[model samples]
Target: MDKYTKIIEQIKALEADMVDFKIVDFYGRLRHVTIPTTNITDKKLQFGFGFDGSNFGFAETGKSDFVARPVIKDFVELDPCLEDPTATFMCDVYEAAQDVKPYESDPRGILRKACNYMQSLGVADMATWGPELEFYLFNDLLVRTDPQAMSAEIISDEGYWGSQDDDYSFATRLPKKGGYHSVPPNDTQYQTRVEAVRRLTSLGYDVKYHHHEVGGPGQCEVEFNLMDSMVAADCIILGKYIIRNTAQEFGSYASFLPKPIFGEAGNGLHVHFLMKGKNGELVFHDPNGYMGLSKMALSFLAGILTHAPAITAITNPSTNSYKRLVRGYEAPCNCCYGMANRNAAVRIPAYATQPEEKRFEYRVGDATFNPYLALASILMAGLDGVKKSLDPEGKFGPLEKMDKGWEPPVSIPASLKEALEALQKDHQFLLDGGVFTKGMLEKFISDKMQDHLRIERTPHPVEFEMYELI
Candidate 1:
């Protein structure tokens, strides 16, 4: 009958015994509250369930009250791990009050506001983002930390050291830089990739393809078809959930940490985006321009490169993310664009010929990001570029070794603290059309700095390896 009734009917027909509501906090962590099916009601859908906002890294303890409402369209059945059939729905959060409104810090709401703001400015009708998510699957991971000792280790059946161990005689280990698209025996995670793809597509993710990434220690990647900004963010969360849980079921641990291994390629969530003009025409295509990108597209690229230091604060927010953003390992550290150049932070893919397909890829970001904040920040930067008519060609030259007077644009922020400081100094663009509030930016920076402080105080096991003799 009604929308809420239809949702209940679907859950009942699926034989779901429990309904789970999932939400994303400011730092992009997934949190959930599950209720038995018997508790499902139209009134509950309207009013939502309460949760402590402070626990979610948002409000302070004195003001920690929030509500979560189900996004019924995002419902899906759980994998067969549970004894009872369970359904899950991604949720939107609200401030807990007599007149509840969208929570300003709710990651999803932030993105929505960004999209609406762009339309209000008449920049574009829609934005589409395609992500190439990279990660690792380890056979096992161990960590031991105490006041007196700190140690850690990661074991991958595909690691080069495995052949020397007594467990396996077949030397299936891939070299540090030689794991991309390697065949079976060497690439032991092929079947596991298939499982992740099957689970993702079954849940409505348009997984284009999957393959082994360039890391010897079980690094992998999955590419999905482009979806609008909001849908892309939603799919990312779901895709990550599926990937992590799938790896667990297959007797492995999955990590999206940017730099889980040293001296090798790191995992990144590289995203490609294109926009639609107000006339409903794809705006990125221009055969006459460089890489068939429209003027608007180039301008968008300029915006992103100009604000990259601040954007890094949102896109690659974690401290480990900096390890991946550094100058080696094809990490895209330079603030330049090239035709399919892997070293440049932004590139116009030469393969995309169709107008709708022509887009630019930002290679600096990693999967540790909150997709909402990351995508929104990038879009706002691009919109600012369009407003300013910034010419990318003038900013940086084509991929070149060196020239007498040549210098790339300002380099990426060296660390999380540096990125945060950049955002603090130059975040006025994010305030355009009220897309990002001053409070949200301050809270985000304050909260994320804790991660940096936590790592700064801790002694890495590597430190002990070097300093124990000293």
Candidate 2:
């Protein structure tokens, strides 16, 4: 039997009542359609279901016609919720004609193009990624912005400051920066983490583990097992869905916002990547070399460091993102690489002992980014470096040694405006593989600039307390 038939039979055997086919848009939002189990057929899988892309910021209303082609290989069973038993599938967006795959505008298509382009260059058959998912769980959240009033508030039962509240008698409060791996009483989300792991594993994700992150107030992380770049990106979207749904089930909300609370640590999605050749040899590995890094690895690092500020415009796209990029927090403010340095933008982890494990982590990205596009852009930049043998010009510290005299490179862009300006100037590398087209770049810039303006025009709550008197 064909794969789709096997999937349908599996669904039938599982007695699944509903099937959800979802597409991740350019902005990384999950848009899906739910259908009864009776409709799970091979014809539906081949022809694909149609949807309007305009709602997803794709195009004008008139040109919004699109179809979602199910990727059966990416199918998984849904979490056990009280509502209905369901199966889920990731889909590719295509034009109504279905002959031509949608271009750069489609997030999935962009990822496919990136993979194919990498193959075309005869560089690597696949790219692998491991993203440390970071997020905050809160009991209550509220926000309002209008002509007469504007304010935002978030309350966490697990917050260090909220421990004294009457509702938190059972809670074990963590001190500031004390949340990392705290056991039972202090890690209030233990049950939630277990549920998240079970759900993610049920959905075919090999979860590493979930734990309380460095930030107090319910900050947590669920690390998935590594996968190829494209599949990893898809997993990221699905992982977020599982997190949100699981949180909702427990009467809580999960947010990936980088800086959900001020005066505390922030959430960051640090991605570790590996590039391997067709012979199954890691191109980045050299045992005798610096940090066991080959020349190609150094060039790849150079590409990323050179294009990091521009990459940040996409990787850390949100205005609140910059709030976490300050110096003292281990955020990657400096555009440099070092062996086992948490302070560097690109960190070569000391954990890798084998050729496959020898990978570097890019610390700039947060949970706000579209993983497919963000990863693809980084790959393209690295490919550009490979093509040009781009020497890292600015400042790269001692690869083998570090001393007080070795100053780190200049810092990454300090603000969204600066990051955007960097992107505007340095985005040619993103177009190397046609993974990110000019039209898409233009739209992204326009959308982000509007977001920047919206935040810029708004008055801060602190402003009323500080500037009103002045």
Candidate topping TM-score? 1
lDDT of 2 by residue, 1-470 (tens): 88778888888877788888888887888878888988677889876888888888888798888888877763446645436778777788888754746645788788778889989998788888888899988876788888778876777776766533454434576777878888877787788878878877766677888889888788899987678887789778878887888888888888999998888788899988888898777888888866788778778888888788888998988999999999777788888787788888898888887776888899999989999888888888888878777665346664446566566565688888888888999888778767788888888888888888998998878888998988
- Writing each residue's lDDT as its tens digit, candidate 1 over 1-470 gives 77888788888899998988888987788888889889999888767899998988888899999999877663545643345788877889999998999887788988998999888878789998898989998987887888787766788888876632566535678877789988898888888889889888776778888998889889999998888898899888888888888888789889898998888889989998888877768778888988788888898899999999899999989999999887768888878888878888897787888767889889999888999999999999999999999988856545653464566868888899999999999899998888889999998899889989999999877887799998
**Judged by lDDT against the true structure, how good is candidate 2?**
0.81
**What lDDT, from 0 to 1, does candidate 1 have?**
0.85
Off by over 4 Å in 2: 74-76, 79-82, 98-100, 163-171, 392-394, 399-410
Candidate No. with top lDDT: 1
